[model samples]
Target: MSKTILYARVSTADQTLDHQKAQAEASGFVIDEVVADHGVSGVSTTLRERLEGKRLYDKLRHGDTLVVRWVDRLGRNYQDVTDTIRHFMRQGVVIKTVVNGMTFDGATQDPMREAVRDALIAFMAATAQAQAEATKEAQRAGIKAAKHAGGKYRGKKPSFSRNTFQVVKEQLDIGQGASAIAKLTGISRQAVLRIRKDPSLADEALKRWGE
Candidate 1:
């Protein structure tokens, strides 16, 4: 049987994976399994490197269908996203996205259809990469503006414990992915990335709150 599997991700703890699953179900996918990487940043982590993402590789079989909210959930870089999709296609797995109802099937031998499919994949991947870069640049600009205004760049105060902060720092020092840290601590992936990018800012926020 060709099983339908749902792979969902969110960058913030406040976001729920249930909505993604519901979207899939509404799209008529009879999902047999669901793999989620909640509070995981797609900008910094490749799909394969994510905790639940790795499990997808092991779980999906030939003839299976993989469903996602969008192509960005698969990856945020053009090369990474395209490569991942092609890899799955080559393995006889069909990829579907709930948002746009996009489908990528490698089973087709028609040259024209294959070209169109590849082109769509490239476009989506490029768009995802561009969006991620734009978002990062915007964040940098915001931080710079704040610093210029004589405001210390204390990022948002994370709603986690001091121990969670310690674990975040340790994970970052050891080169752990933000998604993994967020998963372990139940904090937003953005929070983990913020600490990874500048622990000092996060520390300042903690101090300000007397944590």
Candidate 2:
């Protein structure tokens, strides 16, 4: 019998992984194991890079079933998300999402079914990518507007700690994009971009805030 695995992700400390698992259970999935990535954003981090996510890659075998709350939990960008799905499909693993209960199985040999499945995957992946872009754009615009209002923009307190900031700096030094850093560190992309733009400013703020 194929094992059923549940993968859950929460981008911030506020989100709870247990809730995601509960949601999956409520959706009637008989999850055999749970793999969770806490304080990890789905917008840019590769599946293989996440702690539990990487384990999932190694633990999953052919004919396994992977369940997620939604496609966005798998990935944010279209290419990355689709590639991950395709990889599992090729491994003879079945992918299913709890939200809409969509399933992708490689066992199907019908060309028309395959085409339809591919189309759905493309549409979902594109939608996820667009949403992430829109969110980042909105954050940028909000910050810009706040800046335009003069000294009223004191800025939100940094969500990350000193160690996290150091990690962000290391990722930046390695030429990682703001989005990728944000996803990996669980910080907002806007914050990652700000840190990338001015590491000194971020450092000063962290010190001032005593983070």
Candidate 3:
């Protein structure tokens, strides 16, 4: 029998921990112990930097199974995730994913299986790292654009609350991505699309405060 330890993480404060826990439980993983890094940014992959992340390395022992919701919970990038998993396996710890039912251990000697698993891990880790980088890039771009564009965005008067439709139009004009604009403006992306679609609102802008 294998002792499973559930690990869960969420990127932001807005996200709830229950969702990740429920997903792991639903996948038939017995919640022996859960280590979570709540409201911690995923950009930092170091275990010591994360809240409960350090506990994972300290509490987990050899012959113990580490169950993660996905490979991303292990680390942020390809090298980090792969290296960490490999190191744990070397330490006699087995790594498992609740979502995929995949396991990585020292006993597996099949070259093809190892290759495939490595490929999958690489792909997912790359995605996680890329996402973090993309978020950083978007924030930088938004700040730069806001300062450059006239009334596009200002610290004094926020872009959305100042002129919702005009801000949307300006963001559209600046070629900012919908999601990036939505996140910066705190307005629904759908609203940005609607404002873009309907030019009539361009002339009659709303007061920018309502439900």
Q: Which stretches of candidate 2 lie over 4 Å from their true place?
A: 151-211
Q: How well is each residue in 122-199 modelled by candidate 2, as lDDT tens digits?
A: 999999888889988988888889779873444556778899899999998999987778779887665676677788
Q: lDDT order of candidates, best first?
A: 1, 2, 3
Candidate 1 lowest-lDDT run of ten: 10-19
lDDT of 3 by residue, 158-207 (tens): 22443666676788898998667777777655555556667564333433
RMSD of each: 6.1, 8.3, 11.9
- Computed on alpha carbons, the lDDT of every model, listed in order, comes to 0.85, 0.83, 0.69
Q: Report clash pairs, candidate 3.
A: none
Q: What lDDT score is found at residue 205 in candidate 2? A: 76
**lDDT of candidate model 1 versus the reference:** 0.85
Candidate 3 achieves a global lDDT of 0.69
Candidates ranked, most accurate by TM-score first: 1, 2, 3
True-structure lDDT of candidate 2 = 0.83
Q: Backbone clashes per model, in order?
A: 0, 0, 0
